[model samples]
Target: MNLTIQFYTMLSMIGMGAWVGAALDTYHRFLQRPRRKRWIVFLHDIFFWTVQALIVFYVLLRVNEAELRFYVFIALLCGFAAYQSLLKKLYTACLEAIIQFCVRTYQFFAMLIRNLLIKPIIYLAQALLALFLFLLHMLKIIFLGIYKVLFKLLWMLWKLLFIPLGFLGHLLWKLVPQRAKIFIARYAGFLKQITKVKGIILKWWNAIRTRLGGPRE
Candidate 1:
């Protein structure tokens, strides 16, 4: 009975070791090297070793009353060696195929969502923008037309007022006293000085523009 129990324990330990090997391979392939996070990698290592230790301890406890024996270690090593030699390639290939399938499935769904949902929203926004621009352009044209009409009316009013005012001023000038005529002459001289200064500034501005290769205004 004792021999039978030991034999079964060895078998169980071997199976457990194969499972551990497969788990480590999966981690290396999918999680360990691919992820660059230190804390996460530490956690994965800790969890993997902790679970393996617990499993080992439990199996030992059941089979050999938790006795630490050289044969138990040997059995585990043999199992791991067998897995590496016979099963590693097949398991890795299957794992890679599964990963590829999952990636393809995700991409298909993403493309579907972009076509069905995102594309329509983008098109609707563009149409609304075009409509807004058209309305703005129409409003600008209407306002410009109204401004031109108002400006023409105001210019006509200014011209009508200026002609009457000019005639009144001439009549007043003829009726003024001699002393008042002298004051008006002084004011007229000041106006001529201002016009002379304005002409000089315009001449200098045109020279600067020509030197800078700017078109004459």
Candidate 2:
């Protein structure tokens, strides 16, 4: 029974060493080697060795009641040598392939989600923007049409008023005294100046409206 326990203990240590070797190889391939910072690499090395030492110590305690033996150390070295010589290449290749497959799968799903969800949302936003612009253009055309009709009516009313005013001015010019005539002339000049100012104000107003994306005259 004592000999059997010793053999089993050796086998367990050997298996543990093989597993540790594989874990170290995987860590080096994926995490340790790609690091650019010396401090980060050092921290990782320290953490890896610490965790491995704790696991070996636990195994030794469980198997041999925490007794230190030369043969136990030898068994661990032999197992690590076996893994390096026989299994290292195959295990590393399989681990790399598995990692690549997972990365490809994640990228594929991400692209699929972008196409199904994000692309459609962008297209919908563009369509809404186009529709809004079209509606704004139609509103501008309607407002311009109303402005044109109102301007035409006002112009016609001004012409109708001018006809009677012209006749009255002619009669007053013939009948009025010189002083009265001079007063009427001054009043007519003032009216002309007022009309000029009105024209200037209308021009400025139209320019402002046009700049604001409203209809132009």
Candidate 3:
């Protein structure tokens, strides 16, 4: 818990520092006069960078070797300060203000993206959900269509043929004993005949189709 709190505090500090740094950069670049106070802006930049660097250094020290890290931190701070001032010369006097404005603009967009992109990760997970639902609905419709056609075919068969077969089966079942060895024998023979007839018909159909240049069964 202590570590969690420390980490949160550190994160908050970094966020606040970034906000301040960006604002300062914007102010110095655009709103403030460039010729008026070069020394002041330089000093302000140094101070803010130093505070930020110190915070960073402190955070690192808590997790790193102290002596070597402190030296590195100092060197980094010096480099950071130098870079901040050097930007004025590097980007050219005319473009310095524009560059500063661009930095602030980038920061704004970055913050915007961070907030906007992560919020709906779970809720908006399926941008494809609607497509999935549509596909499911289409599949259901297709299945139902096929089912209705099949049911109609079966209904016709029952009316024309299966009803009679059912009646015949019922009569046989009633006349035959509930436990009949002969019933099993007859049933097996009937199945074998049906299979043999089907195979013969299929072979004949294939032969006919082949002669007619149609697909084989």
Index of the highest-TM-score prediction: 2
Model 3 per-residue lDDT tens digits across residues 63-143? 442334234434444444544555435544546767779899999998888778865664576766877899999999999
Sort every candidate by lDDT, greatest first: 2, 1, 3
User: For candidate 2, which ten residues in a row score worst on lDDT?
Assistant: 208-217
Cα lDDT computed for each candidate against the true fold: 0.83, 0.85, 0.62
What TM-score does structure 1 among the candidates reach? 0.61
Superposition TM-score, candidate 3 onto the true structure = 0.26
**Candidate 1, number of clashes:** 0
Judge candidate 1 at residue 38 and give its lDDT. 87
State the local distance difference test value for candidate 3. Answer: 0.62
Clashing pairs in 1: none
Q: Candidate 1 lDDT, tens digit per residue, 1-217?
A: 3888788778877877787788889878877556568888888889979998898899878877877767778888888888899998998999999999999999999999999999999999999999999999999999977976675576568669979998999998899999988887879978899989989987886676576454554
124-151 in candidate 2: lDDT tens per residue?
9999999999999999999988987776
* Candidate number that wins on TM-score, 1 or 2: 2
Best by lDDT: 2
Question: Per-residue error at 110 for model 3, in Å?
Answer: 1.6
